[model samples]
Target: MSTAAHSLSSNPWKQGAKDALPLLGGYIPVAVSFGLFSVQAGFGVLETILVSAFIYAGASQFLFVAMVVSGAPVWLVIVMTLLINSRHLVYGPNIAPYLQKDVRWLPLMHLLTDQIFALTLTRMPHMTPSDRLRWYVSAGVIAWLSWILGTALGAIAGDELIERWPLISEVLPFALPALFLVMVLPRCTDRRWTITMVMATTTAMLLKLFGFPNIAIPAAAICGALAYYAIQVRPTDKEERS
Candidate 1:
């Protein structure tokens, strides 16, 4: 049949894998740092890998390691992990509409991370449903593998690397935020989104300045989302009333 459709059918997963390559640049170092930090924080090698494999969460993992090192109880750690990752509640629902209807998408939920979510959100609208699922899984596999590789490297060679290149370790902690910023800035091009982002950033910054860094993130997210909703819904209500 059609050339474009044939091309998509030929190797959609490979196209998905290619799209995910940019995220790898940020993910590897952050994940490597996770492994290295886990060791420094008293996790064994197997424990480090398993945590990366199972939790697959970046920020929550950092919090988990810190709490563990501080002698937090297991149940507390699990609860805190859930709290820190609760944003996934929002992320999951956002992407579910774009995913396959079958059971395969269920397990892929475990593969969801900030980078994967961002990548999917940006690209999925342009993809056919089948291609979207193929691309999502393909990109997710790359991200997952990269994290595992980074963790293994950190577990094995992290100490020596730290000794030789201390700044590399120092810079790793900033990678996740930078990656998020990169993803967000482009998506904020619309006027409504621009206003929402500004509101969120201002709110979050003010909170942080007032010594509430912990509360700043969720508050900002809520403020931004609500601001966008209000802006969007007001016009709809006006139209309906008229």
Candidate 2:
């Protein structure tokens, strides 16, 4: 291999970017949908773009636009958005141990998204500790840029495009969720993860049925974590008793 090719392959940042390439297919369409929806809900193109650039939370941004369009108060919007995104509280610590201790994490934490977290979780085990941060940052930047680009496109010309091809709108919303499933499903091969997945899914479904849809996702996540802990501890407790 050429020296330059070998160098690129060895660089954590480049490897991260390469890993993140598949995420574009997901991030772009969903971000475009967000931008288009925000504009249609009466936001300016710049405003829509800023939402993607700054807020950067996927589904929460859509929820924010919807709530604002419905004339919800500012405090409520902030609270609801935070609630929807509270899952990140779990995401951060789970990935933190894999990162180098000396690396500054506060600024980089903002780039943590569901997709990026999942990507890193699965791949970081294979990476050296020092490479983790660089790889994550590179992947995050790529995902972030794709989202912004998609938002800009949708904000600027989404209406015209949708009018020209109505079917695109229907399909865009599914892209991100599909991407997430593809990343997560492989991990379910582990029995603990499979049980956790089942528990989480059941909890979410039960909550939705009980008329508590807004809290379902976070609650499911909490339950799943607890369930996994219980499963993990049972083996230890049996060993102690023996």
lDDT of 1 by residue, 1-242 (tens): 45665665467698778878887788889988999999988999999999898888887787888888999999999887776576676677778887777898888888788778888887776667767778878889998989889888898789998899989978997887788889888988678989988998899899989997655766777787778778853366768899
Clashes of each: 0, 0
- Clashing residue pairs for model 2: none
Among these predicted structures, which one has the highest TM-score? 2
Q: Give the best candidate by lDDT.
A: 2
What candidate 2 gets wrong by more than 4 Å, as runs, is 1-9, 206-212, 233-242
lDDT of 2 by residue, 1-242 (tens): 45644454468888999989999999999998998999989999999999999999998898899999999999999999999788887887788778776647778887888889888787777766667778888999999999999999999989888999999989998899799879988989778999988998899889989998778878887888788778853366768899
Q: What is candidate 2's local distance difference test score? A: 0.87
TM-score of each: 0.86, 0.88
What lDDT does candidate 2 reach at residue 83?
A: 92
Off by over 4 Å in 1: 1-10, 212-216, 233-242
